[model samples]
Target: MRLIVKIMLLFPVLLYSQSNFEKAEKLFSQEKYALAKPIFENVIKENPNHLKALEYLGDIEGMNKSWDSAMFYYGKLKQLNPKEANYYYKYGGCLGMKAKDCNKFKALGMISDIKSSFEKAIQLNPNHIEARWALIELYLQLPGIVGGSERKAQKYANELLKISPVDGYLAKGHIAEYFERYKDAEKNYTKAIAIGGSKTTYQKLADLYKNKMNQPQRAKLVLETYQDKTKS
Candidate 1:
């Protein structure tokens, strides 16, 4: 009799927890993160090991640019599921954001961990396009004394060619621009634009023409075309 009463009492609590989780998930899917966050927190309180709730909370914090808070949640997820590539990727991204706001000395200290996390993510998922892109940018931006190498950037760009030709050309154009090879950059950027008429590619070409080649007319033309396309 007492056991039956306890079961009846517990059933409503379980139903409430499931209903709350479903509501939180629906809100999260709609990107209503501000509304979803507290519900997820409540779900976590009810079931502390709720993986999806924890993951969504991390994603919500990340979307809000709360890097430290995002890292805390993602770090917990990574500890709980070390083999998940996306967890490491998110953790690396949060670390990168934190580094960006820190002093040079602190940022330098974080660089290795950031690199390792991304690398581990790639190792776990070889076709992770975003991870490859992150590594390419990291290599291109870093100084030689650290881990920056154009050659490494190029290698990743070549790998990107296998995954996405448009991204590969853009990466090559960026590398060429870094080397002050304006003509090569122009050629590659043009090729990228031809392959995929992305607004970003057009913007890059316009910037190159205006800043690097000193061709305001060409830049203006590109921008005008971009505006027309966007309006259409």
Candidate 2:
């Protein structure tokens, strides 16, 4: 009888917390992050280990470019659930963004942590697509002395081929573009469009032609083709 009474006493509080979280989640889905953040804060206050609330708050901070704030939430999330791949990934991404605005030496110091976090995420989930993409970008952007390697980037890009063909081609195209290999980028982007043909794929190729290759006419033609394809 005492246990039943205790359960009854706790149920209302739990219900209120759940309802508050639900309301916050609805606001978050609508992208009213400012309004949602306070409710999520309240949810976390009531239940400190509320995973979704923490994740949502982290995401909101990330979107607002508040990297340190995002990192704090993601860091707590990883500690709370060490097995969750996405939490580590989010923490690494926030670290990467934070490094960008700080001094280069400080950024260099963070390299290992950032790399390890994303790598750990991949280790925990072999088929994680976003983690692989993050690693690919990291390799492409880092200097060779700091462990950057086009080969490594391509390796992940190849893995993406097996998991997602369009992403694979897009990543290859991105690497080529970064290196100023315009023709190679064009080929990869063309392949991506041939296979996927979405607006994003089309826009990528058009951007390459217009911005990098100085081929305005080609860019125009690509967009026209995209329009025709979509119309049909």
Candidate 3:
């Protein structure tokens, strides 16, 4: 029958796609991006809307600091899946990174789009932590002549506190450190270490001691304490 012939012909193509995708996924997982990229490209060529393949390619480009390429893929993903928060987040992140190297006027022009993208991510998912963190940093760093506001930054920090206590303390500490309020930073970082005790918290406190406060001895002591704890 004609139907039987169509099924027979199509099965091989589907099988080939699946097998190739699996192999590409394995390479990607192993961090062999160069090897994986071409295969994923082929897969996307055959199936132009392949989500995972597109995401992998976007991630590879992001790792290589090819922001425009990453934005192209992520932009496609946003169009394909508009409600997906992470796609918007990645797109915004790519734009932010690209803006960093541009002329000040160009970077300023990019701010609205960057802010909207991250805001869209948060609007899509209210509990999105990374989007909130991005907003906090954006508000903190932008000059008041534009849109910067400590109040806006603190608002997100406060939201972070409600969602995650560790991040809350860390955010407050970051603001304090930015203002050269070393003792306040130490207080918040100390609380963060007590609650989380992760390497990130430890390193943050250590870096603060050494770089900001210029207390190398205290930094050394903190790192030494962390190493001893890890060994035990």
| Model 1 clashing residue pairs (backbone) | none
- Clash number for each model: 0, 0, 0
Q: Which scores higher on TM-score, 2 or 3?
A: 2
* Sequence-dependent TM-score of model 1: 0.83
Q: Candidate 3 at 44: error in angstroms?
A: 0.3
Top candidate (TM-score): 2
Residue 66 CA displacement from its true place in model 2, Å: 1.8
TM-score winner between 1 and 3, please give it. Answer: 3
* lDDT of each residue in 43-161, candidate 2, tens digit only: 99999999999999999999999999999999999989999999989999999999999999999999999989989998898888898899999999999999999999999999989
- TM-score of every prediction relative to native: 0.83, 0.96, 0.94
* CA-RMSD of model 3: 1.5
Model 2: residue 34 alpha-carbon error in angstroms:
0.5
User: What 10-residue stretch in candidate 1 is worst by lDDT?
Assistant: 126-135
Q: Candidate 1, residues 2-72: lDDT per residue as tens digits?
A: 99999999999889988999999999899898999999999889888777889999999988889999999
- Screening candidate 3 with a backbone cut-off below 3 angstroms (N, C-alpha, C), the clashing residue pairs are none
**How many residue pairs of model 1 clash at the backbone?**
0
